[model samples]
Target: MGINDDASAGQAPHADALAAGNVLNALPPGYRLQEYSLDGVLGYGGFGITYLATDHNLKCNLAIKEYLPSDQAVRDGTFSLRPKSPGAAEIFHWGLSRFIEEARALATFNHPHIVRVLRFFESNNTAYMVMELIGGQPFGEWVKRKRPLSEADLLAVVRPILDGLAMIHASGFVHRDIKPGNIHMRTDTDPCLLDFGAARKLVSGKGGELTAIVTPGYAALEQYHSHGHQGPWTDLYSLAAVMYGVITGQRPIEAPARARNDPLPKAVAVGDRAIYSEVLLRAIDWGLAPAEEERPRSVQAFLQALPRADLMQPSSLPPATVRADSHSGFGTLDTALTTQLEAALARHLGPMASVLVRRHSKEHTTLGPLRAALANDIESETSRRTFLERTEGLLRGESPSRPPTTVPGSRAPVSRPPTAPPTTVPPMFDPQFLAAVEAELANHLGPLAAVLVRKSAAKARDRAELFLLLSDHIANTDQRRAFIRKSVAAFKDKG
Candidate 1:
């Protein structure tokens, strides 16, 4: 849409008009503000009015953000900016100085995905920031026009934004407010990060007053408290929230509410697993964690958590062969031994293991063929070994030496406490031992390596079974030796 000079025509009335009127204090058409001429209003944000203007000298369109804190200031009939009350003038000028500082700081950077500040100057007793007018709909509007985005499309838009965010963070500033509304999608599909006013306060540390401006569902929990320690991870939280919105066509539950009760469903938990990879979905969930430390510490770490496009193609999507047959209703394996095998496989394959085991059971009922198929599904030799070690005896009808005592994904000891009655106790699962296995496994397989340990540990009846399980998942002799040494240390710790 072309910019218009009419104050009421372009900007929507603010929802809280009494507190902050939605009207843009548009300068009259042809009115000159130094090198630029007023053209129309772009939009109103909590801190400023972004106006469409013509750069007279440059002969191009520009977006000028007017430092008009609607709550503290107002425009008279002649369009002169003034504080609402005598007591509010100090706060208004303070914010004005921050707005100019934001413009000056942004002018020094030149990144493709970041907004470019062209100039900044005082106009009508207020500060104005002139930026190159970006061409594209706001990301929120784009999402509405395009309901659901593909994995490729989502990554294409987000990666560049992350790259830009990384640079911003490297400069020692955080984009505390990162939401769909501030993300602009160019016609070429490049995403442009917008609105540095909120971030500017944080960067400049002006007046030591917290910005307190936040968009619910996008702001990290720590942001709610002024004194809370916020860093680069805060932006990562909002970025993940934006991804969640893109995938589900819905905003996640607000962060404050999530702390009391995390009612918001994960991207995978909400039926997005079919379209998105578990790694990507998990990364999104990980980034969205309420606690700051629980989230990815940096943009690079978050990027690493995402599966590469090439790897995602082959391993992220569940294999087509695992689908259940509608007519026979026998697509899954459920024999007690097979059940145990499926549990083991699920640690590696995520939710797909159940389907795969059942399909393999129907096609390769015999142990020999079934074992071969299972091995083919596993990517690591160590993981394959673990699978065989657990199932070999089960397939041969050998009774387990002891009852299973370990819980999947937990390292807590399964053995009874020394103070407890011995009769009620099963066996113990040593947290130290499981922790060593997970740490060693993670070096080779990333975070999911722990899954291999948890699944294997859960089925072990004794130390022998546990050793067999660990050996199966760690094929390298030196790595196996290292694990053994760590286990020995753990055993000593328990003793």
Candidate 2:
């Protein structure tokens, strides 16, 4: 879950007493769960509690979400959650199963824009989900500090989220909640879509409908009723409402009010035309339509309706003098060199490497500044240093230590010098084993796992060597050990 801003709102009478009671129910600091230690409560809501925790095995921070469902359940003297009433037990258990299902489904997604679920387990008569702890402010708070953002800046945030949501929709899920507080903005990586507690699979008829969970001013009209028709258009409405809030500094009129014939101002009319493009504003209006039928039907349709040319333009770079290298000129850099650099950087970053390269290339005609700029985006110091060393060799016109691989989205591989053939060709591992490794690695590294696994498999001589090579990509000592142990066990079972 992303950082929640207001957990205390909508509390029943005896709010203070309820808060203190809930604290007693929460896990105390230093309490251990497998490899993780509870540090403190990050936030709580009607559904569950999210705790800040340290992964003792991985030696990093993470979040643990416990299924309490405060409205229908409570912690007893033994600290195990039981239904508040005998009648509620069935509903409570049903919700618990849904929570577990959600964790399993989320674990399979390797999208950078979606919050990554690391592990899930059943415990204490309920269930728990361990997720990557995001280190950034909520998009709601970010907008508070940096309102009146340029159209380009807003698209930078919105485009990645739409891409992630599109993936979720294609996988048969709908993020029922898409408020500003649920979007996390990271300094080093792309913004992430968070708080999937309200997410549900796209099922037909009444059997598929679950209890309605909504955020006011952001939710679509269909979300107000349990049996109302909902799909991709439902989420798009909430996202457009978020955009309306970002541009006009206030959330649009809540959907129910608009459904009652109350006026909701158009985004185009409210926003400054000079600062924001009419196409973008009108697209937002189209998304904010009270009737789901009136809204853009899909993410692709919504994206097509928005301004596109500006999104492709590189973000402006800080002014710097061009370096003295003859290859450094005032115009675009050499196409071949750019391709080589993108391919090298992609090994460290993922597919986003090309976008980052293009974003910086317009201003950085010189190799030195461009490399430095790209390195800054990398979060790990070790990875950044390694990237610099590799690119430094490339910029100096030196032959790579190994053969160049193909860059994603490119038609051909980066050209390499001829070399003597090796005495032995590395044997290929079973396809099933490779897929298992990729899935396991994705638990830790998200979307980058596939790329890392493919590269490591190419160089590894055997199953053991392959696991060892892939383990290097994981920074945590205990996690690497765990990954290797699990992979070996899996390989032995297959054999």
lDDT by residue for model 1 over 1-495, one digit each (tens)? Answer: 111111221122122111123355656556788888766566666677777777878788777778777778888876789999988898788778767776788778889998887778887888887777777666766666665566766777788998999888888778787887678777536888876756643445543345555677788988886566677889999899888887877777778898866888977677376678665777788899898888777787676556554334544343546545443233443355555555555454433344345445645645556656666666568877776676566555553233334435322222321112224334677787678667765654456456556766786554434544454434333554454444433432221
By summed lDDT, the worst window of 10 consecutive residues in model 2 runs over 8-17
- Estimate, for each residue in 1-495, the C-alpha lDDT of model 2 and write its tens digit: 221333232111111213223564786677778788877776566667777778887788777878887778988777679898988898889888888997899878889988887879987899888888776666766666766677777887898999999999998889888877677778523788876766778766556566576677888889888777889999999899888888887777779999867598888788898678665777888899898887878887676566554233344222355455565332335666676676676665544455456655744777767777777766579978877777776566654344346544332324421121234664577788789889997665544467667877887655544665555545443554466546534553211
Clashing pairs in 1: 14-22, 332-358, 333-358, 386-472, 413-429, 414-428, 414-429, 415-427, 415-428
Question: How close to the true structure is residue 220 of candidate 2, measured as C-alpha lDDT?
Answer: 89
- List clashing residue pairs in candidate 2: none
User: What TM-score does prediction 2 earn?
Assistant: 0.60
